[model samples]
Target: MNRLFDIFRNKYFLSTAAFAVWMLFFDKNDMLSQYEYRTEVHKLQQEKDFYEIETAKVKKDLNELNTNLNTAEKFAREKYFMKKDNEDVFVIIREDAKD
Candidate 1:
């Protein structure tokens, strides 16, 4: 008990404790701010990864469309509802689906 009291009474120990408290709570970049920054970085990293995957898939599709005429026609027919000049186009929309 006496030793603990002496330690607390020491100027160096008190100064160090005060500095730690200041840095942890009072500094411009405190613990909470650092944690928020880290979380924001993680969220942005995940978004970047998702976008990269989507970009790769789009590039692959573009390559396929550029290389294959049949695939391009199929894509246009299915995606844009395009039809031949002599054919009639009929669009069937489900009740639950949006325009």
Candidate 2:
């Protein structure tokens, strides 16, 4: 008991314990920062996955449009409202029955 008390009362041991507590709770590279960075990394990974899926869809569409003229023309006409000369274009709007 005396030896333990002597060690606990030592200045070096007290300083070391205080430093460890400060480092664990108040340091720059603490647990909170690690959790925050992990959350940010997970969010970025989700965004990357979404963008990759979108890129793959676009590439597939591009490949289809490159090989199929009818698909290309249909996409152009639907997306851009493009039409050939002497073509009669009609716009049909459907109102939802619930609305």
Candidate 3:
């Protein structure tokens, strides 16, 4: 018991222990801050991955559109309501569908 008390009473040990406790709990960049930073980094990585996947899909679609005249025409007709001369287009809408 006396040996333990003597170790605790040493100035160097006391100061080092106090500093460690303060740094772990009360510093500006503490354990909680580190955890939050890791969480934010993970979220940004997920967003980057999602954007990369979407970019790949768009690139594939663009490549197909540039390579095929039929695909280009189909995309134009479906996406932009484009039609050739003397063509009638009918758009069907469901009343219960959400926009």
Point out where model 1 deviates above 4 Å.
85-99
RMSD each, Å: 3.6, 3.9, 3.5
Q: Which candidate ranks first by lDDT, i.e. highest?
A: 1
- TM-scores of all predicted structures: 0.78, 0.69, 0.76
Instruction: After the best TM-score superposition of candidate 2, give how far the Cα of residue 7 lies from its true spot, in angstroms.
Output: 7.0
User: Which one wins by TM-score: 1 or 2?
Assistant: 1
Sort all candidates by TM-score, best to worst: 1, 3, 2
lDDT of all predictions, in order shown? Answer: 0.96, 0.93, 0.96
Which candidate number has the best TM-score? Answer: 1
Model 1, 21-87: lDDT tens digits are 9999999999999999999999999999999999999999899999999999998998999999999
- Candidate 2 per-residue C-alpha lDDT over 43-71 given as tens digits, one digit per residue, 9 for 90 to 100: 99999999999999999999999999999
Which has the higher TM-score value, candidate number 1 or candidate number 3?
1
- How far does residue 53 in candidate 3 sit from its true spot (Å)? 0.6
Model 1 steric clash pairs = none
Write the number of the candidate with greater lDDT, choosing between 2 and 3: 3
